[model samples]
Target: MPRALLLTLAALLSACSPRVLSAEGWSFRIGDAAGEVRLVSRQEFGVCSPKLVGCTVPLGHGCLVMLDRDYFLNGTPRQRTLLLAHEVGHCLDASVLEYGHGGIGAQGAVYGEYYRPAVEGFAESYARAYVAVCGDNLAPLGYGSGPACALPDPRTVRVSLP
Candidate 1:
């Protein structure tokens, strides 16, 4: 094919590219905990940087957000969903700090381990609690900072879905 034809083809493909849904500082509530989801990536994971698999960028009051969307991982749909929830957890934690609200991470040691930082613990615990509410006790263990596992009972924890 000629270069001109190739360029035209590229332009057409780019124009037809599907748009990915994204939100900035989207507010949400899970049970008694309420906060904004800083960044929620649905089909992609960790698209922010080339080196990162995933991350949460914190802006004042939490607006600007970027995650590691660099490369494709051999992640299954279920695992990607978990990663998405984890990133949402980061957003929730960021809002809690800015707005002075009682988000899920406020409960120290309840959702996270003492050895790690609160931010990571927040994401990890939020993921666990998310799965807890869904009753996914059979989820694969040894994920996140605290070796995250689903909580014992769904009734013990409250989760809000929208």
Candidate 2:
């Protein structure tokens, strides 16, 4: 396409894009909010060893966010979903923080042979809690940090997914 036409199309798309506020300092599109839990691409993972397939942010920019690889070539859907939710659990562990890259690296234990189970436990708990709530209707959210699976029992305060 000609430069002028490309520029015009870009401007049109930008104008058509939804404008959302920075809720709690992070904002996403309507599609992201539509799902009970947001499933983001692995490119979003942005940290940790390559061998590690999933992650959740417990603090800083991505706190409470969970992500897995784009597809489960090396994992099952259930496993990937649980992994992503677990990462979100880490983010929800405490109030989100604004740690720099070095601080986040230290917290995530990227540099050491840390007891990963201790950290992974949170993700696991979150996944279990989520699954217990949403049950089978959560197929569209795919395998990642989903709120559907973590719904509180009817007697609890957890909100129902849309």
Candidate 3:
């Protein structure tokens, strides 16, 4: 999709509510920190399956975000931030490296070496990489040292703002 269209969608998503803004901020920051590859939200990811979480589709263009109302409202800010970052990691996986063209079968495997484990492994690796460089000091945002807060390379994941 065109960058302009993507930005427009992001703006529309952000305008949905305050939660969207917060989520967008997290996505933007993380994307910028990681360097290269753009991250944005879509209205719907086009696939709804049990295997994928947080609007993850195996088509692999980017992640489609859906902030659960309960989590956004009741969960701590740190929790929300981590969740957003995690989902964004999945987006990065789709758009950049593993842009799988296969549908549900290729996307969601029931029994194979290339299914759940590989997908989660890649996502976790990306998250860990981000944390390692960025540090877990999201304290200013009222977040504490969660799993993502203790990264080792707090410098590599910095994304440049446009």
Candidate 4:
């Protein structure tokens, strides 16, 4: 194949491939349901703070999950998977609100707190559960120590994916 054709093919293949977020002993595949997962710098992870590790932005149909490349580069596979799972949980939970569960910005309603510890707790629990189900040896990183899989009652609406 010509050089240009080869480059085009590579780009196309990359576009079609599922984004893989991997660490030392574990890896998670970000599927089409999540839209796109971008690995960015800490400064890019959030607004005015290069120290943030990850974030999730909800899109109409899917969502965007951004990981801090620097954090992951220095962290263990367990840490990476834990953070990725937490962000994914945020996206998944937000989907419920986007689908007209309660109303616009229903996630805030469910959070129902000054700092939204409940929301963070749920994400942490989700990460713990996911790691357990996958049978990975790594211990829960952040909120895993709090609850096993505790999600707020108000935010526990059923979501059907197609």
Backbone Cα, N, C clashes tallied per candidate: 8, 10, 14, 2
lDDT of 4 by residue, 1-162 (tens): 233543343344344332323212221223323334566665544432455687666654345566777786678868876787767666655654443332223233343342135455555555555665543332322222243333333244322211
Instruction: Compute the lDDT of residue 150 as modeled in candidate 4.
Output: 32
Q: In model 4, where do residues sit more than 4 Å from their true spots?
A: 1-32, 46-49, 97-116, 136-162
Q: For candidate 3, which ten residues in a row score worst on lDDT?
A: 31-40
Model 2: residue 62 alpha-carbon error in angstroms: 5.6
Instruction: Identify the runs in model 3 with alpha carbons over 4 angstroms from their true place.
Output: 1-46, 49-53, 57-62, 100-116, 135-162
Query: Which order, best to worst by TM-score?
Result: 4, 3, 2, 1
TM-score of each: 0.40, 0.41, 0.43, 0.51
Ranking by lDDT: 4, 1, 3, 2
Alpha carbon deviation, residue 111, candidate 3 (Å): 19
1-162: candidate 3 lDDT, tens digit per residue: 345545555465445433343453332323322211222233322233323334433222433355454454465654555554555555555665453311122322333343345454444444445444554444322234444444322222322211
Score candidate 4 by lDDT: 0.47
Candidate 2 per-residue lDDT, tens place, 33-152, comes to 211122334444344343455543332222334243344435665665455444444444432222122122222332234423434433344455655556533342443244433342
Lowest lDDT block of 10, candidate 4: 20-29
Report the candidate with higher TM-score, 1 versus 2. 2
The number of the candidate with the highest lDDT is 4
lDDT of 2: 0.36
